[model samples]
Target: MAIHRKRFRVEEAIVGEMPSPEMIEEAAPMHSEIMAELRAIRAQMAKGTPPAPLSGSAAMAAIDASTAHELSEARTMLETYRAQIEQCEKLKVELDLIHDAIDRTKREIATLHGKSFDGGEMAKVNGELGAVVGGTEQATQQILEAAESIDQAASAMSKVQSADQQKRLADDIQERVISIFEACNFQDLTGQRISKVMGTMKFIEQHINAMMEIWGGVDAIKAHVPAHVDTRSEDDKLLNGPKLAGDVGHASQDDIDALFD
Candidate 1:
C-alpha cells in the first residue's frame, strides 16, 4: 500500500501579549540553546540516518515522539525553575523576619541602656545614683563621727568622769548610731531597682544571641555585619548606673573623672 504524507497544523503555544524587549533579552540565551539542539537533530536526519523516506504514518509518529520528548523536557525545566523561585521567596521572608527582629531587639537594648544614654536621660540616672550614694555616704560619716565622739568621751573618762556621766555618754552614742542605721535604708530601695535593671540586661543579651542564631550563628552574623567592641572599662560598665552599695566593681566618681585625663 502506498502511503501519503499526513498534513497537520502543528500546535504552538499562543502568546497572549507581546513580550517586552527586556523579557526577550532575558529569554534569548535559553531559546538559542534549545534551537541549537533541534538544529543538530535535523542535521542528522538530513544525513538519512533514519533514512526518512519513512512511510507517512511512521513519519507522523516520529514527529509526535520528538515533540513529546521536547515538551516533557521543557515542562521539567519550568517546574525546576519555579521551585527555585519559591525557595528564594521563602528564604527572603525568613531573612527579613530575622533582620527586623535584630533591629527591634537592638532598639530595646538601647532603651534599657537609657535610650542610647541620651544626654538628659544619662544625667537623670546619674543624678539619681549620685544622690543615693551621697546620702548613704553622709549617713555613714555621721556614724563614724558618732563613734569618734564616744571614743573621745571614753578617753576623757580617766579624769574621774563618774559612772553616771559615762553611762549617759554611752546611751547618747547608742541612740545616735542607731539613727544613722535607720538612715541607711536607702540601700533597700536602690538594690531593688538595680536588680531589676540587671535582670532586664540579661534578658536583652539572651534575645540578642537568639537573633544571632537565627541569622546563622555568630560567624555568619559577623560575615554580614561589622562587630563593635565596647571600649568602656569594667569600672565604667558598673558605673553606667547605680550599683548596689559596696559593689567592688563600681568606680568612684573621681576614678571615672580620671579616665578623661
Candidate 2:
C-alpha cells in the first residue's frame, strides 16, 4: 500500500483565544437569530412527540373543577323547580277556595229561589198585601159615609122644634155612630194581613243578607255595587203614602193647620 501524508502551512494553522468584548457585542444579533432558529427546530421536533400524561394531583384537580361546575348547575335547576312547585301549590289552594265559595253560593241561591218563588211565598205575600189595601179602603168608605149621615141627623135635630122629631133625629145620629164603630173593626183584619206580609218580607231579607255575606260584608262589597236607577215617573214619585208612626220629614195635621194659620 502506498503511504500519503498532507502537510499544513504554518500561516494556515488554527488558533484558540478568548473573544474581545467588542466582538461579543457585534455578534449579539447573530447569536439571537441562531438561538431563535434552534428553538424553532426543537418545536418542530416536539410536535411529533406525545405529551407527558398529567400528574395525579393535576388530573384530580381538573376532574373536581368539572364536577363542581356541573353540581352548581344542577343546584340552580333544582332551586328553580322548587320555586315553581311552591307557586303551583299556592295557586291550587286559591283555586280550591274559590271553587268551594262558588259551590256554597250556588246552594244558597237555589235555596232562596226554591223558598221565595217556587214555594208560592211571594204570591201569598202579594195577596195578603192586596187584602190589606182593599180592607182599609172599604173601612174608610164606610166610616166616611157614617160620619156624613151623623152630620145630617145632627143638623136636622137643630132645625126641628117638635120633641118627637128631635128624638127621632137623635136616634138616627146614634145609629150612624154605632155603624162607624163597627166599620172600625176592619183594623183587626188589616193588622193580621200586614203581619203576614211582614213575615214574608223578613224571610226574604234574611236570605238576601245571607247571599251578601257569601261574597263579603256590605262594606267589603260596596265598591261592586251598581248605581241605583229610579224607574218611577215624576208624578208617581210625589205619591208618598201616609206616614207611619214615629216617621219624620212629613207634614202632620198640626203642621197643615199651622200653615193655614
Candidate 3:
C-alpha cells in the first residue's frame, strides 16, 4: 500500500522568549553529560531502519509499549542506584567507626606519653630501680666480706689450742655476724623501691589496656603481635636475671647446680 505525502509552509510565531544567556550558560554545564548521551542516541537512531507508518490504534499501542519499556529500564536503573547508595551509606558508617577508633587510640597514646614519658614517671621508675640495684650490690659485697671473715675465724679457732686465742676468734666471729645482719637491711629498702616502680608500671599498663579495649581486646592485640625473636647473643640470652617470685618455667639454682654434677 502507498502512503500520500503533503507539504505545507508554516508561519513562525513568537510563543515564548528564549532563556537569558546567563541561564543558558548556567544550564549548559549542568546538562552537558545529558546532551552528550542524547546525541549518541540520536546518532544510533539515524543509523537504524525506520519503522513503517502505523494506524491510530497501532501507533497508540506502540507508544504504550515503548513507554512501558523505557519505564522498566528507568525503574531498573533507579533500583541499581538505590542499591549503590545504600552500599555507600554502609561504607560511610564503617569508615566513621574506624575514624572514631583511630581518634580514641591516638588520644590514649598521647595520654600515655604525657603521663609516663613527659611526666617523668618512667624516669622515677628507672631511678628507683637503679638505687635498688646499687644497694643490693653494696649489701652483697658487705655480706660476702663478713662471711669470709667468719669463715677465717672459725677455721683459726679449730686449729687454736689456747683458750685465749679461741675466745678472741669467737669474738671476731660475733662481730662479723653482726655486720652480716646489718647488710641484710638492703632487702627492706629494695622492697620499698620496687613497690614504687610497680605502681608506676601499673599506671602505664592501665592506659595500654584501655587502648587495647578501644580496638577490640587482648585477643585482637595478640593477632597483631609480631613473631618473637631472641635477638640476644647466647650469653645475653642466658642472663635472664633473677626470676620473679611464683614464676614458673625458669630453672632453679638447684637445677643449674645439678647440671655440673
Candidate 4:
C-alpha cells in the first residue's frame, strides 16, 4: 500500500512538471505587462525623455552614452555639410565677378587698340602704341587663363563630395583672381584712355550685378541661353537692309508717286 502511495506521488509530480493551458493563461497578463513597459521606455527615449536611474550593470549606461555621442557627431557633420554648400554658393558669386572682370579687360583692350589705330598718328606713336598693345595682349591672355582656371575650379568644387576639397578650390580661385588683378598694369596710359578703361570695368561690374539679380549666377545665365545660338552679330549683317524689301517683288506706282510727292 505504501509503495502504491509513493508511486502515485511520483506520477503527480510528473504531471505538474508538464505545461498546462490554465497555467499559460494565468501568466499571459504578466508577460504582456513586461512588453508594454519595454515599449513605453523605448517611446520615452525616442521622445528625448531623460533616463531614469537604472539598477543594471554599467554596460547599458555605456551603450546609451555612446549612442548619444554618435547622434551629436551626426548633427555636427550635417551642419558642416550645410556650411560647405553655403561657401560654394558664395564662391560662385566671386567666380562670376572674376569672369566679368576678364570680359571687361578684353573689351577695354579692344577699344584701346581701335582708338590707337584710328588716331592716325601711327608714324609718330607706332613704337609706344605697339608696346602698349603688346602689354595689353599679354595681360588679356593672363586674365582669360586665370578666369578659365577659376571657372574650372568652381565647377570642380560644385562636383566635389568632400567639404575640404570645396574649401581648397574656393581659396585657390580667390587667390588666383587677386594675383591677376595685382599683376595687371593699368598705369601706363596718360588720360582719357585710362579713364575709359576704368569706365568699362565699372560698366562690366554693373552688368554683372544686373545679370546676377536676374539669373542668380554664371551657371544660371548659361542655363538660360541656348548653347547653339551665336552671341556675335556680324557688322555687315547689321548694316544690311531687309532682303524682302530689296527683292523688287511687290512694289507699286503709288509707292513711287508717294515718294516723289
Top candidate on TM-score is 3
* Runs off by more than 4 Å, candidate 4: 1-124, 187-261
Candidate 1 ranges with C-alpha deviation above 4 Å: 1-52, 99-103, 106-116, 161-261
In what order do the candidates fall by lDDT, top score first? 3, 2, 1, 4
Best by lDDT: 3
TM-score for each candidate, following the candidate numbering: 0.47, 0.67, 0.68, 0.26
Task: Compose the digit string of candidate 4's lDDT tens values, residues 163-244.
Answer: 8998899898998798689547544452335455455456556655654654466777677776686455775444434447
Give lDDT per model, in order: 0.73, 0.84, 0.88, 0.70
Candidate ranking (TM-score, best to worst): 3, 2, 1, 4
TM-score of model 1 vs. true structure: 0.47
- Residue-pair clashes per prediction, in order, are 0, 0, 0, 0
Q: Which stretches of candidate 3 lie over 4 Å from their true place?
A: 1-50, 156-171, 229-261
lDDT of 1: 0.73
Give the total clashing residue pairs for model 4.
0
Per-model C-alpha RMSD: 21.6, 12.3, 16.3, 33.8
What TM-score does prediction 3 earn?
0.68
Model 1, position 22: C-alpha lDDT score? 67
Tens-place lDDT per residue, model 3, 1-261, is 334333233312343445545667778876998999999979978999567779999999999999999999999999999999999999999999999999999998898788887747777888999999999999999999999999999999999899999999999999999999999999999999999988878888998899899889999999999999988897786777789999775789999899999
